[model samples]
Target: MQAVIIAALVIGIPLAIYCVCTVKREEIFEEGSGKNAEVLDDDGKITKETTMGRIIKMDKGMGEFLMANGLHCVTCTSSANESLADACIVHGLDADIMLSKIQKYLDENA
Candidate 1:
């Protein structure tokens, strides 16, 4: 019984530590390569289908607006996969209103 417990601890502790390290590494890579290096469409317009990461990549300043609107996951890995419409749905926000605001901001800034 003691041997089993020791073996379990030995295996489990290393496994847990490895998982944590792996996650941190992936986060670092995602932050550097995934978020900052993403390319925007040639038109550079914010549409419902535009991913949050692409929006931020197009204009980092947009992140502030998104956060203010309670869509603060702009920096998260999931943002790379999530579109404005999906994010708005998940956050209980009106997608049309958000898209309009985003386009207005882009127009003014451009």
Candidate 2:
């Protein structure tokens, strides 16, 4: 019927769009959250698995902590390939403590 087709067009189109958008958003969230990624080690340490630049991009507060702890490398081009633990070691910092601080911050905000 004409009424049925009109109703389907009015409702089905938006429903389909919403479903597609929701799926896309979920995919983006999964990638950003690093669900199955190697962001952390088996011992729960932030190791060379993830780069400092990626961490900084995840949270600006984390970036501030890096700078406050004398890690100016976050702004350097090499930072893209520099792991958090490597940066901590190069700056004479304890990577475990730094990772703890960052985890705490994320937990608190989350």
Candidate 3:
């Protein structure tokens, strides 16, 4: 019926668009990326793992965590903007060594 067709068009279009977008997004990237990818440091150590649709997050509040690993993130206002490797360099530490430990902690606790 004309009414049925109108109703279907209104509801079905959005659903169809959503499905298309989802499929296209998936097809563009390999599976196990995005929420499923395991992040690693320069040393090839596992830094964080995704869980229940979330990647394990790091905290910058812990001075010990930052300094012990030689990140120097605790001092720099730009630290939040820096990546692990950059943070290590700014702090005058070996990024590979520091990141290896950070990755190890993240993996063990994650």
Candidate 4:
């Protein structure tokens, strides 16, 4: 009886974790679904991923893009709470231009 319990603990736990990790992890990173369209780049790459459904998944590429374009606020932790539109408004950055440039780069590379 004890041997069976030990075997079950080892095998069952691993199998359960594997199944949960594989199945649940994909759901966490599917995509955005709001009206904002997830702030895609010129080539349809996700710039500011707005899908805060399960966990935070900000588009790191967008942050790099903003920093490259002189928008330093992209690195701030506060950016996690703020939307792309609001950040542009506060930082006096042109959201359209930034987005356009990002998308263009994406299109070219893709």
Model 1, 1-110: lDDT tens digits are 99999998999987886676546434534443222223445565556888775666555466666778788666455566789899989889999999888878767766
Comparing 1 with 4 on lDDT, the higher-scoring candidate is 1
TM-score of 4: 0.42
Worst 10 residues of 4 by lDDT: 51-60
- RMSD (Å) of each candidate, 1 decimal: 7.5, 14.4, 15.1, 12.0
Candidate closer to the true structure by lDDT (higher is better), 2 or 3: 2
> Which is the leading candidate under lDDT?
1
Task: Give the lowest summed-lDDT range of ten residues in model 2.
Answer: 28-37
The parts of candidate 2 lying over 4 Å away from their true place are 1-48
Q: Give the per-residue Cα lDDT of candidate 4 at 32.
A: 21
Instruction: Output the worst ten-in-a-row residue range by lDDT, candidate 1.
Output: 31-40
Per residue, candidate 2 scores C-alpha lDDT tens digits across 16-106 of 8667655643343334432223565686545544787566655545555667867766545455578778888888888788877777766
How well does candidate 4 score on lDDT at residue 60?
Answer: 26
Instruction: State which candidate has the highest TM-score.
Output: 1
Clash numbers, per candidate: 0, 0, 0, 4
Candidate 3 stretches with Cα past 4 Å from truth are 1-56, 59-63
Better of 1 and 3 by TM-score: 1
lDDT of 3 by residue, 69-92 (tens): 554344333233355555555667
Q: Model 2: which residue pairs collide?
A: none
Residue pairs in candidate 3 whose N, alpha carbon or C atoms collide under 3 angstroms: none
